[model samples]
Target chain A: MRTIELSDRQEKIIEIVKESGPITGEKIADRLNLTRATLRPDLAILTMAGFLDARPRVGYFYTGKSSTQLLSESVNKIKVNEYKSIPVVVNENVSIYDAIVTMFLEDVGTLFVVDDKSLLVGVLSRKDCLRASIGKQELNSVPVHIIMTRMPNITTCKSDDLLIDVAEKLIEKQIDSIPIVKEKEEGLEVIGRVTKSNITKAFVTLFKKD
Target chain B: MRTIELSDRQEKIIEIVKESGPITGEKIADRLNLTRATLRPDLAILTMAGFLDARPRVGYFYTGKSSTQLLSESVNKIKVNEYKSIPVVVNENVSIYDAIVTMFLEDVGTLFVVDDKSLLVGVLSRKDCLRASIGKQELNSVPVHIIMTRMPNITTCKSDDLLIDVAEKLIEKQIDSIPIVKEKEEGLEVIGRVTKSNITKAFVTLFKKD
Candidate 1:
């Protein structure tokens, strides 16, 4: 159950494979300015350690083990709530044009449309506004509710979901972000937003382990 | 200015607001059951055109004329990329204990490792032979170079690159998924991976209007 430790040289080799994988052993040794003989053991040790892969005719490559290791580690470390950001909102009575402006001013891609109760009832995005505008639709008279994506079917994530799980949902669903919602006695209310940028930040922190 | 055409209800509101904005009107007749009678004229016109804001006691709010309407529209029309599945890998010579068992038997993760040539050296997964019967430091003595993250930074994607830009890179980043990479001649080797279930997928497809 002892953890395997890597020497600096081995680490470099692993990094190189990870960087330029599916390369030849001779090429790796040449890049490092070491004799194939000198690099062979380094390569062998790395391969034995589950960091590199060697093929008969093909050169060496770095394995995908790093991602799994990273994923397993990320699951244990990141708390879901920490990754959420406050949701951007607009009033239900607001014009579709106004919603579009709000999206730009806030520098966010999506906007949540809410009622007087502050309960999320619909969602709007740049796309909805564009479609409306291109159709030469009346700007001042069109209510966003007509074009907004309604609730329930909206993709949402809970505050307790793990970062890894969130990442999985993003990829599987091919979504740019997920609305974080909380259930109250009346209905579901949007509390925050989790976007692709958040996942990237979380991964960067996770990978910087000592 | 020639006003855009709108639904009957929308047209009436626009006509009312063009003459009476910043003025709250009560009991305005609207078509169907869709209209609320006690609504503000400016708020109705602005909200529909993407320009009005609302406050609690202050009634409807207006933020001047809207700008950057085109940009929001463009963002909405952009197409998203699909997620693809790729194998996970690990080095061979490294300790087979922690990795071999945890990732392999799971049947979900794969392991890639590299050799001196930098070619895809070896491919291991939950199905790899050494999952059970894990030994002591013998695992450490084994080199991962034989089993680790492999060449080409497989699953590599680019920054500033759109979703489809790295769909191919997903297969290259030697792990269970493709990692987002910065644009570089070396293909921006995997900095962070895009998995089959990442949020990008949802943005790429589900939310897309097409």
Candidate 2:
């Protein structure tokens, strides 16, 4: 495929389409402070480049598939460190209920369950809590270690993994998030987490707005 | 917090806010096939119940923080199976480069590196790919095993964890995704993946308009 060079105007047009797809050309032009005449050529280039599609009356909307493709390509070019987020953790001894409570209060989904040494041991999620509750398992009495998913079975991403790669995992696995980990002298240590929301937010920032 | 009983109108208003939060009252009313005047009381009830929030000019946006609280309380009522997602995986012999590519192409952030036995051994991520690429490490030659963050050190969730707990781990870890794993006779295998996007999407669906 021939490379389609996008001018500043063209890039802005793509962003507008992403945010408010199925929008009209006039609306796009108006949002970006450009006249229809000025945006026509850019629109043509974008459409030709497979970045966007235009309908007769619905205006221009980004092809959903194209955004994923664009994101993969762009993310491949970015270093992983640029996108790493902070890490959240739980200890093995923590009660499943406590861990569950912690997860809710923290606004995160995965908890890194660690040993007394702070060595990563297992991971816990809302599902585990649900099971314990349903099983009528004792919350405070039962340790997370009883139901936590152990390591060697955990999926991990490093700090330098690409955002596109992350996005792909979320889609392919139909999973929502992955943890960013690092190799320490002793073992792998929890470093960060990357979720589909982060990828979406990143996509919104990188390609959705001018 | 006191329980707030929602009328059909109020429930619809919450549904609108959840679907396209950070929207305005006017937009919500329009989408619900109602007038702003008709929606006002419902909106008030929802806001008071902590199910919805109103911004000055930004319209209505789902309060991400509040959802976590609501979720935490409601979590006690949800079954574990409701929050699980399918897992995506890669084999141990796979190259880091290939893994990275897989991640990008699949739109996922994490890859579970498994053994021929289908047992998870290590996890790879977009960040890992970035570090390897940036460090100019061998791409075609570097095996995922060499660079993978080994297991027993990774974080994970089970299919039965609570949603509130999952949310907390996600936020505290500052990571985006988590893997769901189940045990088998041979070893542990990944059963699903979860990310913030999934949680948010689930949350959005909770109040979606019919």
Candidate 3:
């Protein structure tokens, strides 16, 4: 796919089409005082770009679609599975110290807390850990579940969920990451992770991708 | 600007132009066993979309620019000043506990540490704070400068720098945020910040922006 900048005349053609109803190409050319040959390329471009639609009996009419809408549609097509990273998990009973160590070892900003069945129970962010660190409680003795944002409060996504929606959730919740979970009879099983870093990487790939 | 998928003949035309030298529209048409009138719109579309360039007397030749290249060009045009957030800073001598409190109050992932002269001295990420928290030292007594990622190793950008470059630095350095700085006689001054969150927001705006 390629992007194009509309010419001044083409923009004028769109304005004309927007105001007029299914106007013929010949009539459009006449309105602009240009020949059919001069207007043909602009009309073709407008139609092909989806700004205007042409029918057999009718001439041209605005498609009511803007470039931004098309761009959004393409962006919204990206799924979580395409960009998610391997989720790092720690047992809910693990010490805050151990979870912090695991985070540093994995080089990830967030860690998911799981139960005995490896089902997600909570999320541990750097902020949560840092907050706990400053508290009077001993880091080694206190379990992560006490500090973690537990499930029901945690924002989660599925593999098929749109990445854009996850990005929005990240912004809205002011959180670092979300666990990509799979539904099970027992609970939601953590399968993947999406962070601002992952979103940033996806953003870079957007333009870099061939 | 609008993106459009190229037709099969358009792709073939590009392939032909890539092989041929400064080919004319008539020659391109003849090679494809089509008349110039039939090929006019395709030629116009290719040229307008930047896949091919046309000359008055020389005809048409491939511009050698792919859709990805154009897409990257447009992406690179976005500058750091357009998306950078306010730089949250703390004095270098401040305790790690105080810095963490400031981070919480400001709701920022990273904090810039400055000297009395307001010159950047170090950077403290949430990871840095978390690391310090798990250490043996007292959070209140230990100054941020001792634990913070100090200058000379800091990743920074100017307001005028391309955001893509900053985004790349974030990925390559495996860092959360970079301070947007200005050079001074004394030292670098932090003016703004660019984080993965900012890049994610920019990604969303890329599609949502009109």
Q: Give the higher-DockQ candidate: 2 or 3.
A: 3
TM-score of chain A as modeled in candidate 2 = 0.63
Best by TM-score: 3
Over B1-210, each residue of candidate 3 has an lDDT whose tens digit, in order, gives 556667899989999999995999999999999999999988887887678898899879888776555556667778989999999999999999999999999999899999999999999999888888888878889999999899799999999998888898899899999999999998999999999989988887776433
Using lDDT as the measure, what is the rank order of every candidate, best first?
3, 2, 1
Q: Write the residue-wise lDDT of candidate 2 on A95-188 in tens digits.
A: 8767776866786666788887777887776545544553557776789999987888777778776655555566555554577777888877
Q: Specify the poorest-scoring 10-residue window by lDDT in model 3 chain B.
A: B65-74
lDDT against the true structure, per candidate, is 0.53, 0.65, 0.87
| Residues A151-198, model 1: lDDT tens digits | 865777889876656666766655556788888888778888886666
Candidate 1 vs candidate 3, TM-score winner: 3
Q: Which ten residues in a row have the lowest lDDT in candidate 1 chain A?
A: A67-76
Docking class of 2: incorrect
Candidates 1 onward: DockQ, in order: 0.02, 0.02, 0.44
Q: Write the per-residue lDDT of candidate 2 for residues B117-184, one digit (tens) a residue.
A: 89878777654554465345677788888887888877777787765566556655655667777888
Best-first order by DockQ: 3, 2, 1
Off by over 4 Å in 1: A1-3, A6-71, A208-210, B1-210
Residue B154 local lDDT, model 3: 96
Specify the highest-DockQ model's number. Answer: 3
Better candidate by lDDT, 1 or 3? 3
How well does candidate 3 score on lDDT at residue A105? Answer: 92
